[model samples]
Target: MKKKMMVGGLLPALVLSTCGLAGAQPVAMDTLTAMEQNPDAGSQMRASTEPVTQESLQEMRRQLEEQLQQAQELQNRLNAQLGSLEKRMKKVEKKSWEPPVEIHGYGRLRWDKHRYEDRNDPNDYKTIWLNLFTKYRINDRWALHSEHEFENNLTTNHGAYEGQGGYNEPGGKKYSRPVLQLYAEGRVGEVNVKAGRYYLQSPYKFTFDDKIDGWQISYGIPTKWGRKANFTLSAGNTYSKIFYGDKENESNYWNEGGDGNLKVVSLIGEIPVAKNTNLAMHYGKIKRRNDRLERKTWSIGFDTKINRDLKFWAGIAKSDSQTLNKSHFLQLQYKEARPDIPGSYDIYIKKYLQRGHSGMTNWFNDDIAEFTHGDYKEENIANNGNDKVFQYSRWGEFNGLRIGVDFVPTRNTKLLINYTFGKMGKCLDKDPGRRYDYSFFRTQWEMYF
Candidate 1:
């Protein structure tokens, strides 16, 4: 009986110890041994430990479940944050590959009047001009640019009885359908390059508006004074109705049978000589097909700031020609007109003396002597008595004074007034006894967008 009771007690204690070990808290070995030695004591101890163990396990399990749910929630929040960051990174990467584009331009309305000393009639006209410019940045160092122009003369009636058949009549509007300038520009280190149809502004070539189909390369030179200096080389062929005439006309030298082109090669340089001053030089050669006509031109000039609000420029130009081969100019300006600032104003005065051969085309004042008579038409003077015959060729010898004022009355809008007066040079009339005086007045309103 005693052996059987001992065995039974040991078996119960072993089972209880095993069950306790599987729980979060284990039973003590001393308590298990004590329970094994007494049957009644073991039964009482089991009854007492059972309720406490069951409640403690239930509390522990509840805590563990709560901790597990919190851990899972924290993990989900981290994943959501990580996903948001990844999406932002992807958006930034996509933006880096897209190019930027810009578009802007201006509109202008102008009134022009021409008066001659010997003629009773005055030429008056009005015109509208529109320009559109666009730029696209392909990358950090490469870009593309384009400009388009449209022009129309609004003064169609010269006089009620003068008829409607004239150069400024209806259907005489002018425009460049595709583009006035289209070019690719890029920069590599200190070197810059431009190719395709673009504007060329040189001393002896087109001043500002004419376009050439070719290329230009410029280098930024390093100087000891840390000033700005540049050297440029350009080669191109100029084709414009203003200078070359229409294709059907015989004067369209670039398209006709005479070598099919007028070529121009030019070198220009700007050197900083002092503070707020620069010395400029230019050399250009113009060659026609078959070597029919070749002209070598050179110019030297200097631009300086007299004060914070005053500036001056003077230059002399010469060409290798037997007749009419000299030109000089002096300009002084005060202040500057800022288009963005209302009530801003600038005033300037310029004096220029140009010979026919010196500047093949005077871009600034091409129409200074457009209505003057040349010596070849002297026979008409006897019959008309001071009546003038129009000069077909626009480029000729003339000396003139130009005064201008530019004022901005509102943001992005400008008003300009200019007056010019001059006398014909020897190339226009060989007779020193006769005087061909002319005056011009122009007023323009421009709005920028």
Candidate 2:
């Protein structure tokens, strides 16, 4: 009875395990048919279709065992692989990299030479100028910028100097000097404030500020057209180191130190005329104050791109100086793109009219001041024969003309050639009679990276 009970339970358990509860119980129809066919058949025979054979049962059990073992092994292998992958992912996620900071600067150098046929002097000179710039970004909202420049040139026959190579001779009209610029600037919403020493120049316009060093505040407000427009209002002071006067408190008519303190104010704008085309306008005033003279100057200018191949620019300015009397300027410029080459060429011309006051003309220095003064000015305070030299060159009025061309080969290289023509209404030299006419041509080549 014990063996029989064990057999019955094992058969049902195997069936249930292989299929489900339904497979554990065969239908009564099969049992009844089996019983009808063989009434003596025992419960063992009725439990299933045929008799249970030891080898067949053993083979089925072996297959089931093998499959279970394989499933467990596969699960273990997958878990190991998953753990390794998780470790690799953690390592990758922990790695970090930093952004790099870079510093760069550029300048220009040239070998300038000229051969003049006049007097067979064959004057030759070399020119070289170096400018360095540095920019640093503290963050998205803060930046620092600065530039320093040093330049030198050889000068000869520059008429401004008399008696070749004197101790105080304008130093060949070339000298090395430090131009310092340091500023902190960033955009505050739509307005920007820049404070500290900076170089300022008007675009589409020219201002006395171009020659002076000062600080400025610029605001860049947005316009309604989705285009960017900004106006710059600036004030700065400029003065020449070459001051002339016998005494600090004394003022002279022909001296430079009396009122050379240059002050300037400007309003300039950058506006878009079209997609790739822009318009610029500038209006500004420069004032000079000193013991002897105070001057007021105004300038207005316009610059625009007419098309892809053409550009137009024009400006007019007027000045009233205590020492210079009255001065005026007119300028016109045009640029045409050369389609055949990679470089562009441009040309500009300017005409100037200036009335120099009597005491403002520079004709004699300390050595000749005693002797040449009488010949240079209408009345020499020192009473010297230099007044006679002034009779031929000083016209009481001076006019000048400048014409120039610029060629740009790339973003970093440029070539400029300019000619300045000057005329004096008053004569200080006998050879030119009562009028003086002369021209100076200068060529500059620049490169940077």
Best by TM-score: 1
The TM-score, computed over Cα atoms with residue i paired to residue i, of candidate 2 is 0.53
Model 2, 167-192: lDDT tens per residue? 25522222222645767767777677
- The residue pairs that clash in candidate 1, if any, are none
Candidate 2, lDDT over the whole model: 0.49
lDDT of 2 at 160: 23
Model 1 per-residue lDDT at 276? 86
| Cα-based lDDT for every prediction | 0.66, 0.49
Per-prediction tally of clashes: 0, 27
- lDDT of candidate 1 over 83-191, digit per residue (tens): 9999998768757865378789999998989877766898787877889998898887999999988766678633221222343443221222347799999987878
Best lDDT goes to which candidate?
Answer: 1
Question: Looking at model 2, which ten-residue stretch has the lowest summed lDDT?
Answer: 363-372
* lDDT (Cα, 0-100) at 281 in candidate 2: 60
